[model samples]
Target: MPQPVIYTHQLTRKFGDFVAVDAITFEVQPGEIFGFLGANGAGKTTAMRILCGLLSPTSGQANVAGFDVYRQNEEIKKQIGYMSQKFSLYENLTVRENIQFFGGIYGLSRQELKDKTNVLIDRLGLHNEANKLVGALPLGWKQKISFSVAILHRPKIVFLDEPTGGVDPITRRQFWDMIYEAAHDGITVFVTTHYMDEAEYCDRVSIMVDGAIAALDTPAGLKKQFNATNMDEVFLQLARGAKRGD
Candidate 1:
């Protein structure tokens, strides 16, 4: 059996009296694409932040790459890459410069950074734009570059928070191809998105509502479980049920 790359036990996070993530538990298998589905304010981002070691869980445990989120945060950080909903690259830097800067931070040697930067530039089809300032790139290209920078270190797990948000449908499809390529290379992808169609691309998905998981399964399984025709219908049915219970 494949081992889980991510594991959480009763993971909970609270802000004063408001519970942002309430005792949720799930595991992401190695090399799998795990989609986290939720409406706005459903705590999907909160849970991801906790898993990425950006936020501490108020209670319970989270382990990424075998490092405990609370006690071994530094190890976890070294083993994982995270791309937030917001673009994180330095707009003032050239595309190549941005790659070098991030590679440097990951402790890649100068020579190694140069080699990897060249490889990434070619792979992402940014060779012509390598010298262009990142600020001048289009939204789709900027998103692609941001994603490239996030994985420069080749971490064991990569967390993407709404990585394809606001892009055109074609761009989003291309972005998912990149994600699949990563997963095929043995990298575990944990993603959060509002797009039901994208959720169908995941190997498995977990839908959060009001700080808890309302459903967890493959997209087909979820559709079957809800007696729905598709992921959109499945999501709608479960989301409505969750709202009614709230």
Candidate 2:
């Protein structure tokens, strides 16, 4: 078996006296699409923050891309990419400019940037709109552009925080196509979403409730385990007992 790309054991986080993440453990393999699901205040965000090196855990062991979460956060950051639902692009920057800026931040060489920028523009079908400000583009186009840029550096893992939110079903489908391509190219995708249909698309899912993982399995496995017909039913079977969302 391959070493897990993301691993955690008894990982916990707290806010003063309140436990925000409670002894969660999991492993993600390279190129896997890991779905992190939770209701509001279910500690999903807090756990992801710790794994992404944005925050420290109160206790437990974790390694992201072979770097210790407690000691090698800077290195962990280098091995990962992050994208949120908002797309995270500068509204005023032109499409081409945004691509160059983020690629440069990832330390792509000047020549590499020039080459990649052209490829990104071509792949996104943005040739006509490459010079337009990102804010001027439609929401769907912006979403695609944002995802393309997030992985432009080819990081080992990309943490997607509700990457498909607010877009139409068609656009969501298109966004997921990009996600599959990323995974196909060996990028481990860590994603969180409220869409049950989207949950069905995950390689495996871990659903959180009250700061701990309530269920973890392949969608089919989960359906059989819960005796539910779909992810929505499975999620509801667990989420109905959530105490944090109230």
Q: Estimate each model's TM-score.
A: 0.96, 0.98
> What TM-score does structure 2 among the candidates reach?
0.98
How do the residues 108-134 of candidate 1 rate in per-residue lDDT, one tens digit apiece? 898899899999999988878999999
Q: Rate the local accuracy (lDDT) of all candidates.
A: 0.89, 0.94
Which candidate gets the maximum lDDT versus the true structure? 2
Residue runs of model 2 more than 4 Å from their true location after superposition: none
**lDDT at residue 176 of model 1 (Cα atoms):** 94
Q: What is the lDDT of residue 123 in candidate 1?
A: 92
Model 1's TM-score against the true structure: 0.96
Provide the global lDDT of candidate 2 against the true structure.
Answer: 0.94
What's the true lDDT of residue 87 in model 1?
A: 53
Model 1 spans with C-alpha error above 4 angstroms: 243-246
